[model samples]
Target: MRYVHLYFTCIKRSMISRLEYKKDTVVALFSFFFSNLCSLAAVYFILQAIPALAGYTLAEVGFFYGFSMLPISLDHLFSDEFWLVAYRRVKDGDMDMHFLRPVPVIFQIFAETFQPEGFGEMILGVALIAVCAGQLTVSLTVGALVVLCVGAVFGAVIITSLKVAIAALAFIFKRSGPLLQIIYNFSNYAKYPLAIYPFFIRTLLIFVLPFGLFISLPVDTLLTGAHDPWLLSLAIIGAAAVFFALALWIWTRCERRYESTGS
Candidate 1:
C-alpha cells in the first residue's frame, strides 16, 4: 500500500505543477487529440475501400487498433518523463536529483513529471474499444474478460519496460533523442493487424517488437475462440515480467555508470 500511496501523492503534486502552465497543457492536449483523430480517420477511410484486411471486419480492426493503443496511452500518462530523461535529463545532469531522492529512482522520475495531456489518447482508445467490442461476433466470456483486464496491465508494463530500457540507454550515451523516436514510431505497426504484414514483420511484432501481444493475440483468441485462451494471457504476463527484469537490469547497470554533467 505504501507504493500506491507514494504514486498518488506524486501524481497529485505533478498534476498541480502542470496545471500552472495552462496554455501549454491545453494546447498540447488539443494537438495530441487531433493527431489521434488523424490516425483513426486514416484507418477508417482505408477500410471503407478495402472492405476487409486480413479477414477481419472494420469493427474487429477497430478493436485491434484501440486495444493496442489503450495500454500505450496509459504508459504515456505515467512514463512520458522517460522521454525527457532520454533527451535532456541525463545530459543536463538533472537525473542527479532523482538519485538523491528517498523514493525509488524510477518512481520518483515518473511521479515528478505527469503529463495529463496524454489522456487524450486514452479517451479515444477506450471509446473505440467499447464501440468496436460491441460489434464483435464473440461475446466476452467471464474468463476472457479477466484475461483482457489482466493482459491490459501486462501490455502497459511491456511499453513501460521498453521505454525504461531505451531511456536507460541515455545513461550510457548521454543522449539519443532520435533512437527513442525511432523505437516509438515502430509501434505504428501495432495499429494494424500483425498478420496483414509479411512473415518477417510478423516475427518482429510477435517477438522482437512484441506489440502483437498488446492487441492482436488477445483479440485473435477472442475472434477464433480458444479452449485454453488464458494461456495467451499468461504468455503476455510472463513475457512482460521477463522484459521488465531485463529493463531494470539495464537501468541499474547504467545508474552505476552515470556521470552527472554537474551543469
Candidate 2:
C-alpha cells in the first residue's frame, strides 16, 4: 500500500512538472486529440460507403473501433514511455539511475512519465462506447462482462510486452528506432473489422502478432452474441504470458551487457 502511494505520488509530481511547460504541453495535447479525431472521421467515412463489413453493422464496427480506443488509451496512460523511453535510457546509459532506486527499475521508469492526452482519449472513448452500446443493444452477462474486461486488460498487456520486446533490441543493435516505426504501422490492423481482412492476414494477426484477438473477437462476442468468449479470453491470458515471459528473459539477458557512461 505504501509503495502504491509512493508510485502515485511520483506520477503526480511528473504531471505537475509537465504542467510547468504549459504552452508546449497544450500544443502536444491538441495535436494528439486532433490526430485521433481525424482517425475517427476516416472510420466514419469508410463505413458510410460499405455500410457494414463481414456481418458487422456500422454501429458494431464503431463499437469495435471505439472499444479498441479504450486499450489504446490505457496503453498511452501507462506504457507510452515503454514505446520510446527504453531505447533512450539504454542509449544514454541513464538506465543505471533507475537500477539504483529501491523500486523495480521498470516501475520507476513507467511512473515518471504520464500522458495527459491519453486521459483525454479515455474520456472521449467512454462517450463513444456509450453511444455505440446503445446502437448495438448487446446483452451482457456478468461472466461475459468479466471476460471482456479481462480481455481488454490482457490485450493491453500483450501490446506493452510487444513494445518492450521490440525496444529491448536497442541494447544489442546500434539503433532500433527505424524498425520501431515499421512495427507501429501494424497498429492500423486494429482500427477496422478483422473479418473483412484476408485469411492469411487474419491468421498472421491471430498466431503471430495477436492484435486481432485482442480487440475484435472479444468485443464481437459481447455485442453480437458471438461465442466462446471465456475460452478466447483465456487464450489472450496465455498469449500475454508468453509475450511478457520472452520479453522479461530478453531484457534480463541484455541488462548484463549494458555499459554505463558514468563511473
The model with the greatest TM-score is 1
The list of candidate 2 runs beyond 4 A from truth reads 261-263
TM, every model:
0.91, 0.88
- Candidate 2 per-residue lDDT, tens place, 70-184, comes to 7777777887776565547677776777777778666776787878788888888778878988876667887568667876788778877777777777777735666766675
Per-model C-alpha lDDT, please? Answer: 0.81, 0.76
Best by lDDT: 1
| lDDT of candidate 1 over 175-259, digit per residue (tens) | 9667988887877787776677899988888788787766677776676664356777788888899889999998888877788
What does candidate 1 score on TM? 0.91
- In model 1, residue pairs whose N, Cα or C atoms come closer than 3 Å (at least 3 residues apart or on different chains), thus clashing, are none
Each prediction's number of clashing residue pairs? 0, 0
Task: Write down the worst ten-residue block by lDDT for model 1.
Answer: 220-229
What is the C-alpha RMSD, rounded to one decimal, of candidate 1?
2.0
Candidate 2: the clashing residue pairs are none
Off by over 4 Å in 1: 1-4
